[model samples]
Target: MGAYISTFPTGFAGLIPTALQKLLPGAQVVQVYDGLVHYRYGGKPGDLGKVFLFHNTFLVLREFQGPASQMDSMVRSAAGIKSLPPSRGSFRVRYSVKNQFVAVPKERTRQLEGKIAALTHAKVDRVSPDTEYWFLQRSEGVGFFCRLLGRRQATERDLHPGELRPELAYLMASLAKLGRDSVVLDPFAGYGAIPKQVLGYFPYAMVLVSDLDRDRAVDLRASLGGKRGVSVAQRDALTLEGIPGATVDAIITDPPWGYYEEIEDIQVFYRGMFASFRRVLKPRGQVVLLSARKREAEAAAQEMGFPLRQRYDTLVNGKKAAVYLLEVGPAL
Candidate 1:
């Protein structure tokens, strides 16, 4: 087994431990700190790359727990680990302090770079390197020396404004506790991030996604159509126009947060949305929703008789947000 560390968004750190336990069956969760989880796994290291909940997953090369003055020596000692293979082409060093990404001074960065280069016997390419070594210092006496695994590559469909990151979407989808035969729905499926995640990672009997915007709905159909057991539509979320009552097993979506759209009363919007959710959701069926306006969402959901089971206070693109797990049940 190899030791590893994975970074996630700050507010969602608490969820990563349980998420890792669920997603990587054999992995052992060692510890969790702000924005990161350390674990040990015997599975293929590359599989860590496919887990969407982590922002960056790294293989722990060494660890240090002492005064801050010994940081340089710790880095040097970690670089000297004989089991570490030499780098092939190019490599770089990165630094993180207290769960935040920050830039080290050029002189300092270069000094660290020289140590890493000597160990790997590879040239340093600051921009777009073939290898990346990260030094994460959680506090004055705790530091983890690691090598990043499977650096992120940007794609055309990456997160955009008013869109959810695929990692967060995966988390939201997992929160629904779905089964292979579950019938899923995303009534506020803008850009279809949640549905796409469900289709990509989870096995479902059928998926229904809809958007209020005609253009988006067309695009969703064009991209998401022709897939087996998938349906896209242009419909209002408030009514879920054509869907039958109590047919859906789960509703997972990131509804409007009153940013781009004009929502005069947030409670009114949530009430209408939850009312439709209650109608289409089977008894005890779950709803995994992301909302920035949590107070209003909770109030509206309570009034609509949905039982709030769990609420994860997280961040969506630096905005305060909450992911709620609700179930169709008797009025609260």
Candidate 2:
């Protein structure tokens, strides 16, 4: 097992660790920063949707006083790596300064980049941003993730106005704890983001998707094209007609909230969605939903008699949002 680091969004501090734990059960995961996790495992950095970037964790520093000196030390650390030689080697660097030190230095990024080029005698070609080096501010001091990969956003092919971030999507899927050949559904299939993520990570029996918009239906069909056992259609989330009850293994969805989507009645929509979920999901099946309307969803769940398994309060682009994981009533 090797040391590695993973990154998630600010509000999702716990998502990365949970993903690592689920993906590689019994793996030891420790959080070292706001959105960072260090784990010792032999797993390659695949199957991680919510994880932005990960590295082999070449060097682990416990302190950093300032950028200039820290960059010097990082360059020296890079020099010691087995394969980092041949100055002019194309590379990238990521500095994750703590929130409290947001205004530490403006030229820090540039200086660090230059130092890497000068010390390694390698040409710095940042076209890839592969995170050749990682510097993070820990509680004790600033540390460096000498060998790192950073800023991995293309994991999702289809993009929309309010697409679910990769980390959140992965986290939701991981939390479901589904196994091979499980059936999954996404009611509000915007750009098919949640469905695509679930499909990408898990080997499911079937993936059903629907959207209220015609264009979205077409887009979802295209996005899920050629994938085995996938179905796409145009339909309102509040009414997922024709999906047989007690057949679905899980319902993973991202409902439209007030900020980005224009809904006439948010509460009514939430209530209707809860009803739909209860209908389609089989016994012991889970529903992972992303929404900002917590009270509405909670009230609907209570009224609908669906069991709330867990809820994570977090932010999406600074706006208050949450991930709700609910379960169907167990079969008698």
Give one digit per residue, the lDDT tens place, for model 1 in 1-332.
Answer: 99998877666666777778777888898888767888999999888876667777889988777764255655556545555655778888877777667675677777777776776788899898988888888874678878888645543356565777888888889888889889999988888899889998888999998999998899899989888899999999999999999899999998888877899988999999999888888889999989999899999989998889998888777788989999989644
- For candidate 1, list the clashing residue pairs, or say none: none
Least accurate 10 contiguous residues by lDDT in model 1: 151-160
lDDT of 2 by residue, 1-332 (tens): 55555655555565666556755665577445555566665555343433343323333433334553354464455444444433344776655545332332436556666766776666666576433665565543555544553346554444456887665777777677777879988888877767777787777888888888999899888879568889998987777888888789888888877655677888887878877777777877888888888888788777777688888887776788888888876432
TM-score of each: 0.85, 0.72
Clashes of each: 0, 9
Distance (Å) between predicted and true CA of 295, model 2?
2.6
Per-residue error at 228 for model 1, in Å?
2.6
Task: Please list the C-alpha lDDT of all candidates, in the order they appear.
Answer: 0.83, 0.67
